[model samples]
Target: MPKVRVHNVTISLDGFAAGPNQRLDAPFGDGVGWGDDLHSWFMSATKDAAAGRTGTDVEYFVRGDRNIGATIMGRNMFGPQRGAWEDESWQGWWGDNPPYHHDVFVHTHHLRPALEMNGGTTFHFTDEPLETVLRRAFDAADGKDVRIGGGAAVIRQYLRAGLIDELHLAIAPILIGRGERVLDNLGEGIDGYRVSELVSSPNVTHATLVRR
Candidate 1:
């Protein structure tokens, strides 16, 4: 079966995925103490491998892209904009060719025409409910898995719905005092899920939560 999976999601020691006050300038957040330290490991992975960077961080980061046929992300994760998208010029932080070479769905209240980019990436903006989007993603994925690329709120929704099959969280070393929390107020929604694996890299600790 095709699984709904989340991977390489980095969170601070304080359990915040991103700091408050997100804007165009600050992708993660604005004026956070730790800044982008929570994602340092991820940044390293994007660099040339000749940099001598290796270990669990690189291994797990690379694993997130494998066998992912479709991707779903919140509008915030897709871009820094909020509310109505006045400017359609923003094609996401990733350049002309995004890393996701498959169909990518952006969950938002305001929908827009599908934007095709260089490479095989196509951004489909939708206002549909989570279930509907997941259905479409599954159809687009064919037999492959669908990845949930999140910014905390989106991941929390899937967790509340008990729809996520696997979640891989990277706990960074630093702690931001305030920001968005991914695993907050889950209640019984996460009762069926448990940490199946745990490993610590030099920069961050990895925890894999699998549903029972």
Candidate 2:
């Protein structure tokens, strides 16, 4: 069975995953950028390649090309804003060659044609239910795990639905006082999740969670 996992997601100490006014210029919000944090995390995660210290972080961040077959992201995560895309010309914020080199699915109410970008990345827009999108992503992954590349809301949905098998959260040291809160509305009983591992790096704290 293919497991659904969320990895490399950086959240602020204030529990905000992203800033409120997210736009093309301010993807992660004003002054709330994770640029340095992300760079540091990626560097550390990839550092052990020479030492053969393969771990979960290395698998998801450094060696993602090996394990990741497909990715699923919310509309906001796919782009800066929401609603029907005004311009079909807007590819994404990641330029002609975005990061993920595998199949990617974007959840949206409005449908758009599949976008083929540089490299092997292809963005598929689907308005179907979450389950449908998950199924498609899993099938596309070819038995490999499907990664939930998110903007918080998407992760919350999957978490509430109990569809996610594993979660790796990179807690950054900074605090965004008034941004999008990731765990705001999480109801009680969500405590079924238990922390399986904790690692502290210079830039962020990595926490791994699994359902109890």
Candidate 3:
């Protein structure tokens, strides 16, 4: 079976996964801003003059996204929207074609209908537990890989639960002062994993971990 993985989750030197006060304009938070400068490496590496991905980024991008059939993300990662949603008009942060061209299970507090978007992306909202959600995602994956897409809190949940088999982090070069930190309260639960691969570039440091 394909391992549960995480890729390209950019973080500040201070360990902040996202900056504070996320809104329509500043989705990643006021610090990183909506543009997500942390993920700038990915954006620059993938896009070309043709207006779409056309380069070595294709190999890396495909390896990260195409190998997976489904993804699970926290509600906040889906959008800056909070509470009861107020309405269903909000699809997600990505307009029309989302980056995840596969089934995406969004963990939410409030119940919402499944959202079908352009490309192969489909969002399924659920308030289920970690195990329940992963089971559903793996089932939807149809023998392909499943990913626990993150925004810190959710990743920590599964990480502590030993749900993730492979983990990748794109440690960006910046500090957001105060925001959501990815390594908070992990304690010894993090000891089960060990770094298996690492690479360095001008943009960022790519670290891949595997369970020991």
Candidate 4:
């Protein structure tokens, strides 16, 4: 069976997965700023690679591309755009060739036509129920793995429904006083997972949780 997983998602020491006061100026919020400190671990991965730095950090970061045939993400992760499509001109945060080289399903309340990008990445937007979108994503995966490409809210939904198979988080040592917390509404008795592994680096602590 294919496993649904999350990889390298950063959460602050204060329990906020992403910072508050989200806006166009600060997508991850001013306190966070996409890649200042909280997400610098991830932001540095590719840059470090280009600069000829290869180590555990590079390996862990690049590992996200492995065995992924399909992915599901919330609209927020897609871009800063919200609500109905006032304009369909926005493609996404990524350029023509996104890192995702497979089918990517984006959850949205508003309908938009399927977008085909370069490098085999195609974005499919949907307003369907969670189960419906997940089932469709699993089917599209074709026995391969499906990754929950997230914003905190999306991950919360799957976590609450007990639909995720594994989750890997890179806990940043920094603190974001306010923002959306991933584990906020996880509810009690939702603890069927065990820590699969823990890897520590100077910048972050990586923890893997796998369903028992």
How do the residues 1-212 of candidate 3 rate in per-residue lDDT, one tens digit apiece?
67798877778777888888877888777768533668777777666523764544344444677578899999998887889888899998789999788999999999899999999999999999999999999999999999888878899988888889988777878778887877678877789999997776677777788899
Q: Give per-residue CA lDDT, model 4, range 132-164, as digits (tens).
A: 988998888888899998989999888888888
| C-alpha lDDT of all candidate models, in order | 0.89, 0.79, 0.82, 0.85
Per-residue lDDT of model 1, residues 1-212, tens digit only: 99999998988888988888988877778655332677878877656244767677788887898899999999999998889889799899999999899999999998888999999999999988899999999999999999999979999999999999999999988878888999999989999899999999888999999998
Judge candidate 1 at residue 102 and give its lDDT.
Answer: 95
Taking all chains together, each candidate's TM-score versus the true structure is: 0.94, 0.87, 0.90, 0.93
Worst 10 residues of 2 by lDDT: 32-41
Model 2 RMSD in Å is 2.8
Looking at model 2, the pairs that clash are: none
Regions of model 1 farther than 4 Å from truth: 32-35, 48-53
The candidates, ranked best first by TM-score, are 1, 4, 3, 2
TM-score, model 3 to reference: 0.90
Q: Model 2: what TM-score? A: 0.87
The candidate 3 region of ten consecutive residues with least summed lDDT is 53-62
- Counted clashes in each candidate structure: 0, 0, 0, 0
Instruction: Give me the overall lDDT of model 1.
Output: 0.89
